[model samples]
Target: MKKLVLTGAAGRLGSYLREPLTKMCDELVSTDRVDDIGTLYPGESYVQADLSSLDAMLEVIKGADMVVHFGAIGDEAPWDDILQSNIIGAYNVWEAAYRCGVKRVVYASSVHAVGMHLKTDTIGLDAPHRPDTYYGLAKCFCEDLASLYWDKRGVESVCMRIFSCAQATNARSIGTWLSYDDLIHLVERSIDSPVVGFTVVYGISNNDRAVVDNSKAGHLGYRPKDNAEVFAKAVFADTPPLDNKDLANLCIGGPFATVELGNSGVAALGVVDDRKET
Candidate 1:
């Protein structure tokens, strides 16, 4: 592609994607709310832009061939905050992509969109929205937004419902983990695929204990290489047995399902800040 725009360039997941994205396009424009993201790759540039502002989104996405949208308040927060950054931000992204004629948007959606479902249910791509928190609710809105844009505006999108994209430190992560290597592969497939009108794929590794199913999205060619079962022994040995009564242990959303509406679910997950350095 000639140009690729990546939002949330300063975030943990965005940091890991910057260097690799540079190689895919002639120019990679990385944008975020931060003033700077330290260093950039050879063909990459940084643009400081807020997700809530439609003008800002338009300016940053103006000449992009495709957009990898990861910019948002990643954790649960107050209603107003979720409305501005996640909901409105999502609308701005799709609108900008429509206006600017961008081909596809690879969104970083979360599993919390269906967090209330039982872990044993094995959620598919067609699962109905059952958000656990305000943050999760925002994700549900964006997924629908992606669908609407595709159906009405001819803008393609792939909403990847990512689970835990960190190390398998907790027992829940053993079933939800998405390794960095696998993440890169998934993003690559989402970008390089020939045609995808409107798709929803679970961003998970090849874990034996995974509760989500991706059989429906096989056309995207996202074959995960890492498995969380490798950490099964240590995680199980360190953590206590699951209590089925606890929502965190019983639901697919893990800690997110148990947190208060406006509280931060990430804080409860105890996820390590192991972002890759650029």
Candidate 2:
């Protein structure tokens, strides 16, 4: 592809993706709300743009072959904030991508979309949306929007239901951790895979305790190479016994499944910062 656009370039996950994405195309346009994203890779350009502004999104994504849409409120929050930054933001991104003649959109959907489902159930790619918060609801909307766009406008999409793309820092992460390498693998597969009209894949590593199944999305050829089992012993030792009555302990969304609508679930997850330095 000659051009690739990535929204949320200043975010933690986006930061890790920039360098590799830069290498994938002739020009990689990275956009975010910040004035700049510190530094740019060799074939990379930064454009400060708001996700909620359709015009801004369209301007940044014009003439792109694909869009990697990781931009959004990363946690549960007030309804108004989530509405603008996540819900409206996603619509603008998809609309802009479609207008720009972009072939595909790789969205960063979350496990919270099905957070209310029990972890023991081992939900599949076809699992119904049961959002645990306003943030999760936004993800469900994105997936549905993707489906609509694919069916009507011939745009391809991959709604990756990311499950804790952080270091295995807790008992929940032992089952949910998605290593940085695995994340890059997932994104690359989402981009490179042919004939992916509209797909949903679980963005999890090859963990022994994985709660989501991606077998249905095997056509994408995503094979995760990392696992969280190495940290399982330490995680279990540091964590307390799971509360049977706690929504976080019983559900796939973990803390997100338990937080109030107007609150944040991030504070509850003890994440060790493994963000890329580059």
Highest TM-score: give the candidate number.
1
Put down candidate 1 lDDT per residue, 85-202, tens digits, no spaces: 9999989999999999999999999999999999899989888999999999999999999999999999999999999998789999999999988988999999999999999999
Alpha-carbon runs more than 4 Å astray in model 2: none
Model 1, TM vs. native: 0.99
Computed on alpha carbons, the lDDT of every model, listed in order, comes to: 0.93, 0.91
Clashes of 2: 0
Candidate 2 per-residue lDDT, tens place, 29-126, comes to 99999887886899999999999999999899999999999998999999999999998999998899888899999999999899999999999988
lDDT score, residue 12, model 1? 90
Error of 1 at 234 (Å): 0.5
Name the runs in model 1 displaced over 4 angstroms: none
**Could you tell me the lDDT of residue 260 within candidate 1?**
86
